[model samples]
Target: MKKKLIFLTNIFLCILFIRFVSAAGTAGSLNINIIESQCLLDFGEGWNFFSFCRNLIDKNASNVFSSAENNYRYIMRWNQEKQEFDIFSPRSSRNPVPDLNDDESYFIYFYSNSYLDVNGTSPGDESRNLVEGWNAPSYQLGFSKTIDSLTLPIEYQYRYIMKWNLSRQEFDIFSQKSLKNPFGTIDQEEGFFIYSKEDLILNIFNMQ
Candidate 1:
């Protein structure tokens, strides 16, 4: 009788251990969906500066621009390290720009007005590192936000902000110290150039 009671106690302990392990596994393996949203981009004739706010499943430039293949002339990306433009033409055999990233911006020249529809995942808690000098970064938010709404990292300063004017083909400038600032709000799918005084990690959008 004593031996049987010991055996029953051991069995109960074993079951408890198994249940504990199962609970631990479930807690450790929590799945979070990152790509939970979609973004639609509109492009016009001349130069359209744009960026993807969400993480794309397929980032290949050719595949992303497949819908507007015949309409666009070329796609250009800024080389921050080299401080030059890397252009990719669909007709060209040797292309410099291959993939399009979420935090980066690109310039596409279209023959006529067209739109790009893409399904992407959310950029949750993602931050972009800005180098000292000129950096072309996209606002990775779903809605439109003004330039004043942006918050930079401590000790880092924004010297100026410039947005590409599609019709005038000129830059609309914005500065904090300027008496008259034309550049006001930043829209979705829009890309802009910002000059940073120091190198720091920039939180593009407030998660809250």
Candidate 2:
């Protein structure tokens, strides 16, 4: 009778382990039904490297994007200047906008203006320069599931004002990393939207 009980307990544990693994697999899957999907704004074959961003005020690039992961590569390329994008990831101010519009959901970038980023990522003051000629980039500004379920940036100078769509599940940026003093000095401007003006954590927006 004791032997029978032990056998049943082992069987139950085995079944529970199987179910737990299956559930985790389901949660880790990436949903393909994005807000918008386009093949026209291709990333082009192989790896592509860019070098600068046009001023946002030059034109409005809201509502025009490809995907959210790699915003710079999926913009509508016209005249080779590339136009129409949502997010901006600052890479040394070189290729700041990445594309006219960013199709990706997450990244680091240079914003046109801190206040203007709330204007639907339109053409505006775009970048993360603390001082003139100090075009220091706001890197590590994208998403990372490898750390946890879904995590936002873990850097102070990497803020991007995002218009999040819960139902559609998207983050369309209007303004990105722009500040009077990204170096955390008293000379900083009025402060970014919900940001603490203070360097709270290395990585904010861990998705609640």
Candidate 3:
């Protein structure tokens, strides 16, 4: 009887492990140390449009846009909705930074894949925002791997999606996700520390 019980317990533990692994993400997992995050619409075949923004203001240690963040605005041109408005706050930086091991296990979270809102129009200093953060633009996913030791150079990222409900004037808060892209850019390192093509995002975006 005891042997049978032990066998059942082992089976249960195995099932639990499998469940956890499957819950990770649909995409093949990558070990990325995501120091920052952002959001956009996955337009398919590796083309994604900067869509609505999501800020993980909870990470007190995360990179934040300056108080002078008012000079910018994010506009999302959803094919489904007409009256477009600001997607998120420049103050609400979309890089969704999450917690990971102190070492080789940092991970990111992606909420959804559809519905895009382009990066905001900030006319000043887009370069400084590039370094202080890592690059996973939109989720709260946890670690990417398990570290047997204390700390090792870590790399991981996670992101999610957001959409608007046409019926609701206010953003959907989290609904329709329509786009898909195997290739996209990561702005996790922008607007925080390293400075380069500061407004590269705005310059590249051709929104009408």
Name the best candidate (by lDDT): 1
Superposed by TM-score, candidate 1 places the C-alpha of residue 63 at a distance from the truth, in angstroms, of 0.5
Report the C-alpha lDDT of model 1 over 30-144, residue by residue, as the tens digit: 3333324555676778888877756788899899889989999988898877878999999988898888878888888999988676656656565777788888887766566
lDDT of 3 at 186: 24
Model 2 TM-score, all chains together: 0.15
C-alpha TM-score for every candidate: 0.78, 0.15, 0.16
Q: Candidate 3's residue-wise lDDT over 87-200, tens digit each?
A: 332335562222211111111112222222222221221111111222212211111111111011111211222222222312222111325432122222111111122222
Give the per-residue lDDT of model 2 (tens digit) for 1-208: 0000011111112212222337446533332321211111112232222211112222333323322323333221222113223434222344344444321222222112111111121112222312211111221111222212111343344344323222233433322344332222101011111222333332322221
State candidate 3's TM-score. Answer: 0.16
What lDDT would each prediction earn against the true structure?
A: 0.71, 0.24, 0.22
Evaluate residue 72 in candidate 1 and report its C-alpha lDDT on the 0 to 100 scale: 95
Residue 192 of model 3: what lDDT? Answer: 10
The better-scoring model by TM-score among 1 and 3 is 1
Show pairs that collide, candidate 1.
Answer: 35-121
Q: What overall lDDT, based on C-alpha atoms, would model 3 receive against the true structure?
A: 0.22
